[model samples]
Target chain A: MLKVHNLSVNYRGTEALNSVSLAIHAGELVGLIGPNGAGKSTLLKALLGLVAMHAGQVLFEERPLVHQRQRVAYVPQRSQIDWDYPVTAWNVVMMARTVRTGWLRSPNPRSRQAVEAAMQRLGVWDLRDRQIGELSGGQQQRVFLARAIAQDADLFFFDEPFNAIDKTTEAVILDLLAELKAHDKTVLVCSHEWGQALNRYDRLLLLNQRLVADGDPQQVMTLDNIQRAYGENLQPSERPAEMPFFC
Target chain B: MLDWLLEPLGYQFMRNALAVGLLVGVLCPIVGSYLIVQRMALLGDVIAHAVLPGLAIANFLRFNILLGSFVSGIFSTVLIAWIRTQTRVKVDAAMALTFSSFFSLGVLLLRVLGSRLDLMAILFGDILSVSRADVGRSLWVTLLLLLLVKLFYKELLFYTFDPAAAEAAGLPVHTIYYGMMAAITMTIIVGMQTVGVVLVIALLVGPATTAYLLVKQLHRMMLLGALLGVISSLGGMYISYYLDVPSGPAIALTSFAFFMLALLFSPRQGILTRRRPLRKP
Candidate 1:
């Protein structure tokens, strides 16, 4: 579980997040949707204690975010990483155990086994030995997810997980998230594809610098809310189609 | 070939020069690999040039040149890191400001201390003139540095590849970052005693970058970089000795030539200057 109150963020004198408050409970898959520069990514980073918060306190399971660091794992935006780094998929996933392993000791057999299982779960076991730079975008995303799984954290923050991924990879990631949810793990995922996220996520927090709405997907994904978040750029036909549920 | 290399062992100067060259060649690339991966090639240049003023001031006060260079390099590193973190001043601009201003101050100091100092040894090192004490000190320092790197190889590799991930992993990314800067300063100071300040950047970046173009794995790149560095250093020494060319420039040019050759012929990312066949319209 996580709690954020009056979380404000500024970038070079420009306010990105303005007094936003929210809570995410355990075992919930919450989708954060907004337009470009909508403070969605900034809010996630602030929650992870990666950014310098202007004014706010983030508590994970009633503990400060920094103190409860090991309980939370983050998968940053794929574009933020330098893809050309000389690291194998295994090495990357193993990094998740670094906090627990400490500086002096290498990953133990147990940790390594956990990494192996995480990689297998993400379907990157065959690619574990490959250099990270050589992996495709989807593979790289899966590698990060494997890292998150290896962390064995109760809470996860994923930024733009579906961006630039193929439909198949997207489905695989969604299935992984579903598995995480089943295990009582909390997930906060930032995404732009509202329609797909609306179907998958348990709760939706629609935002554009300010908190526009927060509730069930059907209630949050409305025409007026979309218009307020995106302004006049919203098209009538662009709203989520009323497709029949198959599952 | 053994006789040629072992024969120089009889002469003290030859022995010192060879030992110093080997140590610098091996040590520079060990640190240089991280520098290249971090895209801080210019940082090496900045540090090399920035140390000049400290050297000049030390010379004016009749202090140890190595000590002076080390102090200045650390100062430059801290200054650059501070500027980047505290202000919106970009990395390149900070590098340019620190190196240029410090280097000019050095030039001015040299002018003021005209004819009172023997700076030729500092400007263009005479490896043949290396004292036994100098050789001993450099060897010990290099050995310690290489040992430290070997011990902390995992941490360094993790930080270089993904700093944010390393931080999230609670690896003290900032401390590692500054630790690397300290290592680079030490390496540059040692290298300056052989290659001089002007050519130090070549030893820092040339071999490692060339190795980068050839290898995918970090360990392989480090190995190949050391190999290239040693080969180039020895080859440059022999060529310079036989041709009576300026040794410093000759050594640097040799590494540069090797870099260009690798650029053209490296298997993975080499530039094929030769024309490709035309596609059908």
Candidate 2:
């Protein structure tokens, strides 16, 4: 379980998030939807303690989030990473164990087995030896998913994991998320593709600088909320073409 | 060939110069890899040039060059890191501000100390004139720095690849970063004596950058970088000997030449100088 109370963030005197609060119970998959720069990524960063919170606290399992970092895993936007790094897919997945193993010790055999299983689950086991730079965008997203899986954490925060990914890869990732829910794990995903998120997530949190609405996908994802959050940004023809597939 | 090359090896000064080159060539790339990965290639050049005033002051004080360079390099690193962190000044502006200001101060110091100290010796190294004590000190520092890098190799890679993730994972990313800066400071300090400030950037960036163009793995890049460095050093030393040229420039040119070769000929990502023919344009 995770709780964020009265959270606000400011960057260079510009307020990114203004007194927003939300919570997710265990086993729930919450989709955080918003326009660009609407504090979606900032919320994730604040939860991960990567950003300085102007006010309020983040709690994981009733403790401060920073102290419970190991129990939470994050898959940042693939576009945000330097893909040219010399690390391999295996190395990226193994990085999940870094918090548990610490710097002085290497991952144990069991941890290695977990990493392998996670890679296999995500259909990236064969690509383990390949340099991360060589992978496609979908493959890169899968690698990050494998890393989160290998972390074996109770809660996962993914920032736009499905962006630029094909439909099949998106389905595979959704199925994996369903499996995580079955295992009573928590997932908070930030997605711009409302249709895909609606099909998979248990709850939808529509946001625009503040909590616009939070409820079931049907209740929260109304055209009014979408128009308000998006603000004439969506032309009728520009509405996601993939909504029918999800329906 | 062995007779001529072996003959020079018999001289103490020749041995010292060779040792100094070997140590510098090995150490520069180890630190330079991090610099390149972090997209901070020019930071080395900035730091090397920025430490000139400290070197000049140390020369005026008749202190050891390493001690002065270390202090000055640390000061510059702290200043640059602080400026980048505290103010909105971008990295390049901060580097330019710090490097130019300190370098000018060094010029001023050298002007005042011109009568007693040989500024050219510090600007452009006299590798052939390296004392045995200097060579010993270089060897000791290189060994210590390499050992530290080896011990913390994983942490360094993690920090370089993703600082935010590493910090969230509870690794001391800042500490590792500053520690690396310290290592770089030590490396540049020892390097200043043999390569001088002007040529130190060549050793710091050339071989490592060349290796980066050639390899995809960190460990392999490091090994290839060291190999490239040694080859450049040996080739430059020999070419300087035969052509009666300045050894420092020869070494830097040789390294630059290798970089060009790697840039042109590397298999994976080398610049394709010859464009593919357009199909039925």
Across A1-247, the per-residue lDDT of candidate 2 in tens digits comes to 7889999988767898989889999999999998898999989998889889999899988899998788888888876788988778998888888768766676799889999999999999999999999899899899889988998889998999889998778888989999999999989999887564475688989888888889988777666677778886654454554332133
Per the 3 Å backbone cut-off, how many clashing residue pairs does candidate 2 have? 0
Off by over 4 Å in 2: A232-247, B60-64, B113-115, B271-281
lDDT of 2 by residue, B1-281 (tens): 88878876888887888888888889888788888888898888878887778778877788975678778887898899899877789999999998889889888988888835566767766767788998888889989988888877777777788777777776777788788888888888777766678888888889998998877777777888988887887677777777877777888999999999888877876677544569995
What lDDT, from 0 to 1, does candidate 2 have? 0.83
Local distance difference test values of all predictions, in order: 0.82, 0.83
Q: Cα deviation in Å at residue A190, candidate 1? A: 1.7
DockQ of each: 0.48, 0.53
- Name the candidate that leads on lDDT: 2
Q: What is the lDDT, from 0 to 100, of the residue B7 in candidate 2?
A: 71
Residue-pair clashes per prediction, in order, are: 0, 0
lDDT measured at residue A10 in model 2 versus the true structure, 0 to 100: 87
Error of 2 at B183 (Å): 1.1
Model 1: docking quality category: acceptable
TM-score of predicted structure 1, chain A: 0.93
